[model samples]
Target chain A: MNSSNSGNVGIVIVSHSPKIAEGAADMVRQMVGSAVPLAWTGGDIDGGLGTNVAGILEAIETAWSPAGVAVLVDLGGAETNSEMAVEMLPEDRRARVVVCNAPVVEGAVIAATESSGGSPLAAVKRSAEEFYA
Target chain B: MHDAHASRSGETPVPLTASAVLVNKVGLHARPSVKLTQCAKGFSARIELALAADGPWTDAKSPVKVMRVKAPQGATLHFRVTGPDSKAALAAVLALVHDGFGEA
Candidate 1:
């Protein structure tokens, strides 16, 4: 069995729909394999189409990598909640996280691929943002 | 043609070169581009992929540049590699492309 501790940079996908987040993560896994830590948070606590801070925070923890974690959100509310989740982390830990401005699916795919290559947090974020190009 | 000649002017011995058609249904989209970049990174060579057989080349290590080619299904991609592991890099890319990126 392959343990989740592959040492690659981690990735968190935030989306309004659980399906979207999971589907995107699936694509990432298919491309990069299981070497990178990956997690997703979607919908609200009540099963509504909204973003939840706790869920996002937990997702971040699930995918935390010593290299760092990059968060990709689908919409504005998800983006806002993702930032709040990062802020909730310890100050030192917060520095290791970044919220990227890119399409959720494409960003997650690129970020996962870059992270699996043992890239640093910033470079992973940059590669994810390259989706805009 | 022109780009191939231009590349030769550098006097760099490009010992590895190959061309493949994009057989995947979606072509060089985000996922495939990621796969291509990751493969290039595994080698120490300077890898490049171009839209034509001979011309301007973009760093294959850059997912953004790989996506810039916007290669669609049936579009041909040319790969040129230089460095110590150039041959290995070219072989890997050719195999991946031949497999249709596992999307065929």
Candidate 2:
């Protein structure tokens, strides 16, 4: 079940500014007390989404120990980028990967920091709960 | 443009490097790039973006002009100014870049 991933959760942050991603992740680290894998992809792609997309995919493949992984990004074409990544993954693996609703920086941190005993999906939902609320 | 800021500060106006993060994913594709160019034109600042290597310093205000450059994701653009507001101009451009050509 998708909930199976609640046991382990990982994050990749995409932002307009590299510093913001790094900075936001740092804040989450302090609050949660653990280091989630962090990747940098400025919103403005001078070339294309290939670099950032590749980095996130690679991070997920390596970072997650048991369950699935989550991705959070600033706005604009972030959805497109995330969607593209999701589409490329195998169908079964796709269920494990989810693009989160939390603000890229804040959401990633919260997800990473608050990861406790729930599935990765559950944790991701909680991280973005505030936004929906 | 050389003495753009010289009159204010006797020190020769050194071209400053300003950068912004592309918060969004789509980037300054076309519509947004147009908006960014328009804002850039308002200032007497000379701005150029370094995405790969080839660059054409087009009129910032003209949408048609900027849409030509295909700026994608994960691209770090270098914006330099040598005009009157070169210093502040760089900051503004950088902000817009971070703003994702206005789309973000």
Model 1 segments beyond 4 Å from truth? Answer: A1-3, B1-15, B23-26
Model 2 lDDT tens row, B53-83: 3444544543334545566667666665676
Query: Over the stretch B12-101, how does candidate 1's per-residue lDDT look in tens digits?
Result: 574577899889999998778888888888988898888887768899888777888888999889998888677778999988888988
Output the worst ten-in-a-row residue range by lDDT, candidate 1 chain B: B7-16
Over 4 Å off, model 2: A1-7, A35-40, A43-51, A117-119, B1-104
CAPRI quality level assigned to candidate 1 from its DockQ score: medium
Q: After superposition, how far is residue B19 of candidate 1 from its true place, in Å?
A: 2.3
lDDT (CA) per prediction: 0.85, 0.57
In candidate 1, position B57 carries an lDDT of: 89
Residue B19 CA error for candidate 2 (Å)? Answer: 49
Q: Which candidate is the best by DockQ?
A: 1
Question: What TM-score goes with each of the models?
Answer: 0.85, 0.45
Q: For residues A48-90, what per-residue lDDT tens digits would candidate 2 score against the true structure? A: 3323566456545654544567777777666567767777877
On TM-score, the leading prediction is: 1
